[model samples]
Target chain A: MTVPSPIELVCPAGSLPALKTAIDHGADCVYLGFKDATNARNFTGLNFDPAQMREGIAYAHARKRKVLLALNTYPQTGNWASWTQAVDRAADFGLDAIILADPGLMAYAAKTHPQLRLHLSVQGSATSYEAINWYHERFGVQRAVLPRVLSMAQVESVIANTPVEIEIFGFGGLCVMVEGRCALSAYATGESPNCNGACSPGKHVRWEDTPRGMETRLNGILIDRFADGERAGYPTLCKGRFEVNDETYYALEEPTSLNTLELLPELARIGIRAIKIEGRQRSPAYVAQVTKVWRAALDKLKAGGAEGFSVLPGWMAELNKVSEGQSHTLGAYYRPWK
Target chain B: MKLALGPLLYYWPHQSVLDFYADMAEAPVDSVYLGETVCSRRHELRLEDWLEVGKVLADAGKEVVMSTQGLIESESDLKVLRRIVRQRAGGDAGFRVEANDMGAVRLLAEAGVKDWVAGPTLNVFNPSTLQLMIDAGATRWAVAPEMAGAALAEVRAALPAPLETEVFAYGRLPLAHSARCFTARHFNLQKDTCEFRCLSIMDGIALRTREGAPFLTLNGVQTQSARVHNLLGDLPAVRGQAEVLRISPQGAHTRQIVELFRATLDGSRSPADALAASREWMVEEPCNGFWHGRAGVEQYVAA
Candidate 1:
């Protein structure tokens, strides 16, 4: 029997507790961001300060676990200084790699710190092998995170064609639109992942209870309204219910979580170097629980061959408890044509 | 400043697209971007058909450039890109290609085709990235529509030299792209069998709030702003910042809109007069908030 490649489980860490919890639960790597707009998950209370980053790095390094800093947001003309400073700190703190999306920042990192390892963030939207290869050639990127839009066949083709290491989203909240290119939030709220490091930013979000229904609006444009006794989700424009052709529906995507448990064996077979879980804004309990389940699943797949591998119901149950809209899907990885 | 007809965002019927190009050939625009930049499934006009249209536009003294799709997801899509890049080789049809994605960038670089335009979606916000793309063979860049006027001025100032910059001046702004087709989902159909529903909705499916407020628009896999982004009033602000002003095609009054912009640029008509004349051609209320450093959909009236 052919040996299955050992896939790295990259987890998210929004806080010190989350980082520690992820490490304790068998995450091979944990990615966090600096408490600034340089990273995409630049929420108010989330992320690490310099002291926290140093401590987190020491803790993970002691346990032989890796730490990757996500410097993923696209910086405007005046904002490049802070992003490059974040890269400087990442290298200074002895972090394993920096996940970046901006080409200018990539060039800066490659030129400033040649020894610093770089991974292309999903926000770069490098959907094809050629795109990934260009990043690899341009900046010597060690790995590239695949956007959650490609089918398994497409992923396989990319892995077969490129020399760059491949990483993919294995679990957590899904972005319906292409990450870097999406401007829906900015069009409505004037804040976006590109310019402001936030989508559907909290300052623009409003929730109201009315006789008609529970209404969620972003920047005065009603995003979704739920009937009595209905569950409500965050009013991201793509996931919100809108009237189209005189009918109301989630015109882009229904709120759902991407769970790649079934594709673990296949991804491993295709030589995906890492699988990242997508919630840096989540709680520590979420980090620990999700990491434990994925760890167990990965262990089982490694122990057994593809013929013997199967998605454990118990793991799926644990993951479903934290799923968005309380629903889970294989997402775009398993195309219907296959 | 020059006028450029941006790549058609909507998927039109085969003859309708041909007719639109035929009319564009006579417009006062300096350049025309030809190709399906939005959807790969929009095969109403194949590559050969676009080349044929390019020949006609070239004959009419319009500089024609082929644009690649913004979002490429399949092998077939890559094949079409290769054909487009390769077709530029054998003949004197030496037309520039605009790359919206890095995949197209790599292919163009591999083909040794320099002097390409980096489409707005490539995300060059700072001078460093713009410089890198310049090194990677980009001769021009369409400034991101969401860029604040002040920030764009900063980028222009910091640029190593005066690179040709294009401003998106008209049409419903393309807000986002998705793996799932919003228009298809509206009809409860899978993307693979989307039934070409987007073709019928010329201006795109208007997405409104339950309370009857126009919020957004759905165009197959692409999401757009409901309000047509009109920068006719802000022409003075972007005059020196951009060398060209781009007008995305709408179904009606596009040629007339081009003439008004040309007149405004030539100082024959004032910005206020041009704004008033072009208001009739716009499908929705005009918004120039991005130039005024506000929400893209918000209208910030200049004093």
Candidate 2:
């Protein structure tokens, strides 16, 4: 039997407990961010402080697992020092890799801490192999997490052309738009992933229970409304219902999570170097559950190859419970035709 | 500040495309950006056709620029990008090209073609990214549309070199783009067989919220704000930071809008009068909140 490639299972860790949980549950690496706007998941009560980061890194290292620091947001002019300082902290903490989006930050990291590995964040919006190769050539970017905007065929084509390692989002909240390239959030809320590292930032969100129904608004703009028994997903602008051509519908995309469990065999066959879970704001319990399922799935795939791999019912059941909007989609991966 | 006509975001008829530039050649504009920067499947005008229009604009003493596609996905897309870069490298086009994506930047930099405009899609938020683009031979950059005026002033001040700064002064704010064609999805058609429906609609199809509030516009893969983003009222403030103010082409009255901006900038027309006159030419309500560092949908009027 042909041997299956070892696809790395990268999990999310918003806190030290999450990091330890991910590693203990068999994650090859756990990615987290600083507790500030320097990282994309800059939500309150989430992420790690410097002391927590040090402890998390030590724990993962002791367990023979890797820890990645995500300093993914683009810095504004005056606050440029904060991003650079975050990079410095990553190097000081001896992170396995620093996931970044800003080219300026990349240049600084390359020059100041040459030894630190750089992984281009999805927020960089490098959708093509040419762009990835260019980053590799310029700043020595070792890996790139692709934005969820490519089909399976396109992803395979990109892998064939670039030498940099490719990591893709395998599970979690889905961004219908091309990351870093979208400004929908900024249009409605005056903050975005590129500037403030948050989309539909919680500070601006208001959920009100009224006689009409349960309504959620972002910056005073109505995002979505749900009836008594209907489930209301996160008020991401893209997933909200809107009117088009005199009909109201989810004009962009519905609230859903990306689940590539069924595509594991194909993903492994295509030589994806890593599979990243999308929520760094989720709880430690979530990290534990997802890490276990993915680890089990990867282990089975590695031992049995593509022919014997199958997504078990129990795994799907567990994944469905944690899924956003209580539903999962293949997202851009399974597009039969663009 | 110079008045620039941004690349036509909407697909028009072949003759209309040529005629529009011909009319623009005489309009009060310093530069005209040509080529299809949006969907590659848009076939109304090819590179040769764009070159023809660019030559006309060039003959009219207008600085012509060939803009590349924003989202590069397929091999064919890359091939087209290479052709555009090659034109610049050969110096046969006699016009500069705008690098919308990093792939284009890599091609232009590698081809040793210096002095390209870094399109707004490049996401240059701070001085560091802007500095890197300059090192890669970028001589000018269009600030991202959502950038506030305060942030623009700060970034421009911190620039290592004196690169020309352009701002999206007027247009329907392009909020997002996806691999999935939103227009196709709207028509319930597959993306591969989209039937070029966008050509029939001059501007994008407007999408509104259930409360009848205009929210977005669907143009193939791009999702734009339903409201037009206007910066005419902020021209006095914009002049402090930006060297060029770009006016994106709309379905109608583009020349009039250009004249209004020129007249206002030249002190022949007051800013308030120009703002009011320009509103008569717009397709939707005006918003400048993004320029003022607020929600892009809000129209912020300074006291």
The residue-by-residue lDDT of candidate 1 on B1-303, one tens digit each, is: 889999989888998998889899999999999998888888999988998999899999988889988888888989888888887644555678898999988888888777889898998899999998888788999888888889989998998798999989988998888777777778777778888888957788888888878888888888889898988888888897899899999978999999999999899999889999888888888887777778899988866
lDDT of 2 at A204: 91
DockQ of each two-chain model? 0.70, 0.75
Instruction: Give all TM-scores, in the order shown.
Output: 0.98, 0.98
Q: Pick the candidate with the highest DockQ.
A: 2
Write the residue-wise lDDT of candidate 1 on A128-176 in tens digits. Answer: 9989999999899989998888888888999999999999999999998
- Pairs of colliding residues, candidate 2: none
Q: Among the candidates, what TM-score does chain A have in each? A: 0.97, 0.97
Number of the predicted model whose lDDT against the real structure is largest: 2
Model 2: how far is B88 from its true place, Å? Answer: 0.6
Report the poorest 10 consecutive residues by lDDT, candidate 2 chain A.
A329-338
Tens digit per residue, CA lDDT, model 2, A3-26: 645999999998888888899999
Task: For model 1, state the Cα shift of residue A276 in Å.
Answer: 0.9
Off by over 4 Å in 1: A1-4, A336-338, B89-92
